[model samples]
Target chain A: MNNRMILAAVAAALVAAAAPAAQAKDWTHVKVGIEGAFPPWNALDPQGNLTGLDVDLIKDLCTRAKVECDLQAGEWSAMIPSLNAGKFDLIMTLGINEKRKQVVDFTVPYASGVASFIVEKDGPLAKMPMTGEKLDLNDKEKADPVMKSIGEMLSGKAVGVVQSTSHEQLITAYFGKDVTLRTYKNSGERDLDLKAGRIDAGFDSGVYGATLPSKPGNEDLTIVGPQLKGAMLATEVAIGMRKGETELKEKLDAAIKSAAADGVIKTLSVKWSKLDLTPTF
Target chain B: MDFPFLYETFLTLIAALPLTLQLAATAIAFGAILALGLALCRISGILPLDWFARLYIFIFRGSPLLVQIFLIYYGLGQFREVRHSMFWFILRDPYWCAVIALMLNTAAYAAEIIRGGLLSVPHGQVEAARSCGMSPFMVFRRITLPLAVRQALPAYSNEMISMVKATSLASIITIMEVTGVAAKLISETFRAIEVFVVAGFIYLAINFVLTRLVAFVEYRLSPHMRQPAPLSAATVAGEIR
Candidate 1:
């Protein structure tokens, strides 16, 4: 037992003593990352504080779950990577989509809005065929022809969508080069640019587009295109957790179900979305 | 090492070359004029002009270009009055807004460079010109401006290169330059490394050509420095001159 050997033993003892405490430490303080640019999901208010439906919903969920939640701002493109890198514990602005599920696990849906698109009310694409219809994207046999015609009509026209979003994939997969795709980093920019006439069309959630024109001065834009749903789009929106996060996912799923059963989700959806977006489940 | 794919990516990036060139050329050309005005104001002996120039330079140079781009494109864009005002036409296009931001940013730095060049022109030479009956404007035009331009070329050329790289930030505001195209490609393909590799090579090539252009200008302008090495009779004879 020379001096170096004694120091090594002391370090080993310290680690051995600290292991239990480390295991016992509660991860009650949860960090939720939301995109401040995405409205009706999360957005920055004039005071530079995060607000919107997701912001409100996350706070409510955290209160019920008894977790100390610290909501943080993040950009959409960087959200998942930041979660994977441990910058935040969960991503909340995300709607549950299969492509995302391939990389991350999502809790049972908390709230859901239909997959929707918007065009200028009086624009050439205003008379797009799927008006007042919700096409099931899973049925390609029915969807293909309609999507093709729509794509052809929108030929040489620009569609603005968020990067890494299902809307981007949907427009690109169906239209390919027939339509010029502009992928924004988030919904606010896409909406702003669409209103500015930089883009001919924009796509996201029905609820988000519903909220855009109500912003202080953006009164001219209207959500006038097809309201799309299913397969290519997720049927519901859910909280995104890291893959293999079974314990966290299970806890969240249970919380979501309880929130739904108690009608907490419905009330919040109607309050924020201005329509009933409650999951049937 | 996928030659076909790499070749395709190269073609796609080259397709964006016109926009990249347009941004850099437009910004630098306008930036030079603005830089001249700013440099003159800093030396104009007017207290307010000098202070305003100092403040403008301090703020633009002190902040990151990305932050400034966002402040102009997104931050000020948040205001309803800004959206409705006459300035909206200029601020409406992301391309023009990007050019304005890049030009203003470059001018701030270039102004300082030009000011240094002007200050370095020998005072005795200007005094001698004045004593020889040259007007103040003539003294500046004959002795000051040319010398300052020659002195400023090296730093000014560096600023030009900086503007070329700075144009990449325009992608954030949705102007589809090389990086924006690369981002869209990667999002669709999910091949970040492959797309960025091709994009990086395009940037490298652009910078390389720009470096050559600057070197050519430097060589041509400093003709006295490039004159055939004293034209020794032995060397001339060897060369059959």
Candidate 2:
């Protein structure tokens, strides 16, 4: 063959060899990624297998979706990158947000969430206004007063958070100038500082926050202030995958919808978090 | 290339560079002093002192720097005595806690470097200094210290660069160093590769300048090792005349 024709034929052969892998994707076999350290949602058992709400729910969703899925536990920071790199077909417990949307598409939210503060039980911050109350941040009229009061109280105080979380954004948006912010790589690391009194308070998800006090030796930590949702804080979490994986997304979306309708999420939520995390709509 | 994003991230990250430099400088400076004492302990013929220094070096070098940082920052405060003690004011601050950890960790490694430098000073040179009517202190001050420092500078410079990199760990405790800001940016943007590339460049630039400065110091210190400067043409002509 002439040189030009030879090059064209080689390129065509390469494309032909790649097209089947792209076009004939199978949904029956799937791989799911999850963060095993985020408690109540997911964590490793003593025997070192992943367990908890996300694990249990994923099993339900995969059954309903009719996919025999293999679950992988990994670092939270690696989730989006790994999924887009094709290491995973889905990532669990990803809170839906605008920034993440640019990189990975999300399944329908399967769990509703909230944010709150935890402080040493003996600290003055433990007596914050609206303790044991629910404050919907979207209702600015009611939230504004409480937000102002919490801000003023926390002024010049250091607050700790796990970096990059939705509640971290909410804390910066509401109390950026008021509180000294300390971002950590993970919750366990941040919790140590909070216990040491290096940080005056810690902001975390309500699921995480409410559960902290009950952990042994965390008796001195009290979850105070309102369970907060809306604004920069994400109120719902979902499975995420690369954008345009339409077939897999549809399969997950349908499974999640049915799981919610059948009360699977509510049952798992109460079992794991000791609270109802069922998404409203 | 997202030049704008990189430029903005650089600005944000550079704002924290002063803190990074401060952490490294304080740790290196204080660590040098501690390391000198530890090195002397090893060379001093006293058995107890030598063993103490050996034990100190072994403990610090064996453990991870991150664990040491956490222990000093958080582990110490666990006891009520630490909180109530007069030293609590310094221990309570994250900045000081990081400095203490970095200093202690560097001292262990730098001690060996200093010890090697000190040992390399020939016994004949010391005897010569002593015979020159110089007092013991004067001999060490004028001859031994200078030669030992020159011997140590190359290895010590590596320790200093590593110390600079170690300052990134201070971010875990809330000091707004370069790595801390880069981490926050990554979390906000979810653009790990881009932000990481920018952060890596910043460290490379810092260490580049640091390496050059160390080379300059070594050049000045080892003037005897340099080839003599070439005479100008007029000077050569005068010599010929």
Clashing pairs in 2: none
lDDT of 1 by residue, A76-133 (tens): 7777766765677788857777677776778877876776667766778777887767
Ten-residue stretch with the least lDDT total in model 2 chain A: A15-24
Provide a comma-separated list of chain B TM-scores, one per candidate: 0.90, 0.95
Per-residue alpha-carbon lDDT of candidate 2 for residues A1-281, written as tens digits (9 for 90 to 100): 89977877886787457432434477788999988887888888899899989999999999999999999988776677778667888998888877778878899999998888989999989889998888988899999999999999999999998776777888888988888888876677788778877899998878987788788877888889998887767668989987778898899889999999999999999999988888866
Q: What overall lDDT goes with each candidate model?
A: 0.80, 0.87
Q: Report model 2's TM-score to 2 decimal places.
A: 0.90
**Model 1 clash pairs?**
none
Q: What is the DockQ of each candidate?
A: 0.20, 0.38
Off by over 4 Å in 1: A1-29, A46-49, A59-68, A120-125, B1-18, B40-92, B123-143, B182-216, B223-235, B238-241
Determine which window of 10 residues in candidate 1 chain A has minimal summed lDDT. Answer: A18-27
lDDT, candidate 2, residue A36?
86
lDDT per residue for candidate 2 within B34-89, as digits (tens), equals 99999999999899999999999999999999999989988998887988899989
The best candidate by TM-score is: 2
